[model samples]
Target: MKRREALEKKKSIEELIKNANDPLKDHLNSLPCSYRHYNRNGLSVYLESGIGSNLSSFKKQYIQKLLKVNMEAAYGPKEWVFEEKVKRKEMVAPDARYVFVREIVDNEDGMQPPGDSFVGFLQYRFVLEEEMPVAYVYELQLEQCVQGKGLGKFLMQLVERIAYEYRMSAVMLTVQKGNVFAMDFYVSQLRFVVSSNSPSRMGFNTSYEILYKAVDCEAKEK
Candidate 1:
């Protein structure tokens, strides 16, 4: 009986080791890092820090401004921005696109989604004042210093995987047509198709193009 008990303990320890070796499990064990809960005032503050003199170009310029700030801060630590003082000129008119933090949840169909379960981070969405599918991510940011650590791609994949699980036709966003880095990243790396002839929305005249990735692809082996 003592021998059997020792074997059971060994088995439990082996199971733990196996779980610890999993990449996702390892990340979760190490995470909840660099997350913030930005409310309206907080979101406003976060945006103001990045973009100056917000104009009402787009209906929800505030949300777009936030995305711009988050993106720039995450990826834009160049000398030219400071030297040329181009940061001030980058501000857009304030509009109604807002951000929120709800929760990250795995759907019944086995897709992980943020903002549905309680992850305590900001999620920016562009929604018309009168629309049903109001939750649309214009741009997603995972903090500046932590950008290249694979977490950004992981979070995006999480969103894509969840959207696919729910049978979403496509996931969409507008990109600054001149943002070659963003265009290349989405179009080449992630396989999103660019819409060549989409109608431009009001006040969003800064070289915008609609891009989308199909969510319903054949399941790949895990």
Candidate 2:
């Protein structure tokens, strides 16, 4: 009964945060504005944050295409189903938040750059998971051109910081067993562990596993 009450309190906390006009603003204010700009490995890019519903049509299409391509490559065409996996409603749900990485383009004329400049994006939401408040990563997709430049780790670290600031218990995400690179990145490099609620642990023969990193010491102990 005490555990149930605690879980309810956590859910309420998450709802309050998600209902804010700018959920990430307070958590991000302490960071320098330049933190959004990435310049390394001869690659320059900028980051922007917004709720999924705010994504422009161009950006929406870009995200769908990028996610489709990446998932297909990982799962193969035989396992890929567009409607089942790439649902637009889920991607653009009001509660879904995004951190977009766009290439830096020079326009001395002071006009917006032509065409899409997006290179990658991370989508996440604050929710109750395993009776704990958690930041759940729905997707992290990057263009092939920008892969292996440490951007993925940088983005995830940002997510962890934000989650910590928001008092979330942990950062959680799902990874497909077929995506060996991603599994290694999360498990080996980032040190995320398989969650106790993962399908494999529950005796379910699923193709994917749920992994998480505890953000709070209390959560780690639990």
lDDT of each: 0.40, 0.82
Per-residue accuracy of model 1 over 174-212 as CA lDDT, tens digit each? 676767876787788777665433445333455567766
> Per-residue lDDT of 1-222 in model 2, one digit per residue for the tens?
999997788678766556433544633464667668788887888887867777788888898899787877676776667543655777888778888888887798653434578899998888878777788999999999999999999899988987877778899999999889999999999999999999998999998999999998867986
RMSD of 1: 19.8
Query: Which 10 residues in a row give candidate 1 its minimum summed lDDT?
Result: 42-51
* Residue pair clashes in candidate 2: none
Which is the leading candidate under TM-score?
2
Clashes of each: 19, 0
Off by over 4 Å in 1: 1-68, 71-135, 196-206, 217-222
What residue runs in model 2 are displaced by over 4 Å at the alpha carbon? 1-30, 82-86, 109-115
